[model samples]
Target: MNQSLNRIAAMTARYYYILRSSWLRLLEIVYWPAMQMMVWGFLYTYLYQSRSAMADTAGLLLGAVLLWDVLFRGQLGFTFTFLEEIWSRNLANLMMSPLKPAELAASLMLMSLIRLLIGTIPVTLLTLLLFGFNIYALGPGLLVFFLNLVLTGWAIGLVVAGLVIRQGLGAESLAYSIMIVLLPLCCVYYPVEALPLWLHPVAWSLTPTYVFEGMRAMLIHGVFRTDLMIACLALNAVYLGIGFTTFVLLLQSARHKGGLLTMGE
Candidate 1:
């Protein structure tokens, strides 16, 4: 236990030093999310005041955007942790260490949480102070909704990380592009019913769809949908399992193919 904790600490320190040294990186953590909140917050305000059909427009749209970032930042955090090691040419060194793969994963998960907090907290607070919109108004269900989104994000990040492991830097773009591709299917600013009839099933298969749906339900209807939460949790479990397995298998494949050594080159 002590060894695992030490490994996690060491890995944390590794990224901590990188973040500490780069002011631009720190700015990036806060900038994009804040910008997104500001733009969406205004649109939400407009809708709230002008749209008679949509009563809870502010809560619904703001909640969806904030919650969606939890997933986006979470995935980016996880992928960037791995990408950092690769970019710094430290993957080989880490692989040679006594650090186990599970420990590495735990450390990356911790880093993901750190990154998520750094990125989202400011935007959340700004939305509250500036727009008088508090996502926490969703109440205790917000906790469950957050967990579901972060877990799904981590699952997607792991899958992308796995691909990078197997394909080297050639697959690194997945870190940025995968989530965007998934954005439409996630039904972030809209509802699943808004999608084309054929895409409804595809949207439902992704866990974030249910999470955003549940968020809207809580805001608009004042009822927490336990069924959507259940479905989201179940789907997340399956995806997480597949993601972790794929990451491990790809890591081994990289090892055998000498891909790790060339990763930095």
Candidate 2:
């Protein structure tokens, strides 16, 4: 019994030594969970405005939930597909294949679309049947909004996959844990104005913020918010470029460093 106890203690100490040497890992120890804590714990503080100002808009909250799920599911779909390859220890085999990164990315994206449809279609219908709310009633703007959110998800997922390839499995959990940080920043359940005055700028910097704000505008005013749509597109372009660049560079780095060969070890 004492021998087993010593082994457990030694193993714990070994990782603590690793954590001591790695600042990013240490930061992640706090930043990862703290971001989620901040996301959910304080996300509701912004909802006071919805209750007070959007009280009469029947579909505002419901619409936000549906759109939020679109973004969430889209990201998971993209990231998990990539993570699964890593888990299965197939990344080296993938890299050795003739497939290009962009092609791989496209395949992941198509998978994301399929996953999003699989997860969302039934829920949307259930919302219609149970709550008498057809998410489709939001109309053509909803399609644009959905597209932008998915683009943002793809961009984030690509960056995440890149980081894992470059940094190894230390970041493996990020695929699941990272996106919720946007729950607060994207103002999913509330308007941007609901955020603290300082957070307004931070929230606006993200494309999904525009999508959610546009969603609110559509629900409340019956306007499509073409201006927000334009802004969302512009930001999505920047994020997608960054994500693509990051992935390609990190992939090259991993390959050069033999990270791919030893990945998942």
| Whole-structure CA lDDT of model 2 | 0.77
lDDT of 2 by residue, 5-123 (tens): 45444433433454467787445433433344334333333553356653455467667767877887788778877776787788888678665687678767876786677667766
The Cα RMSD of model 2 versus the native structure comes to 13.1
For model 1 the TM-score comes to 0.94
Clash pairs detected, candidate 1: none
TM-score of every prediction relative to native: 0.94, 0.78
| lDDT on C-alpha atoms for all candidate structures | 0.88, 0.77
What are the candidates' C-alpha RMSDs?
1.6, 13.1
Best prediction by lDDT: 1
Candidate 2 residue runs with Cα over 4 Å from true position: 1-58
49-145 per-residue lDDT for model 1 (tens digits): 8757765566777888899889989999999989998898888898899998888888888899898999988889999998889887888899999
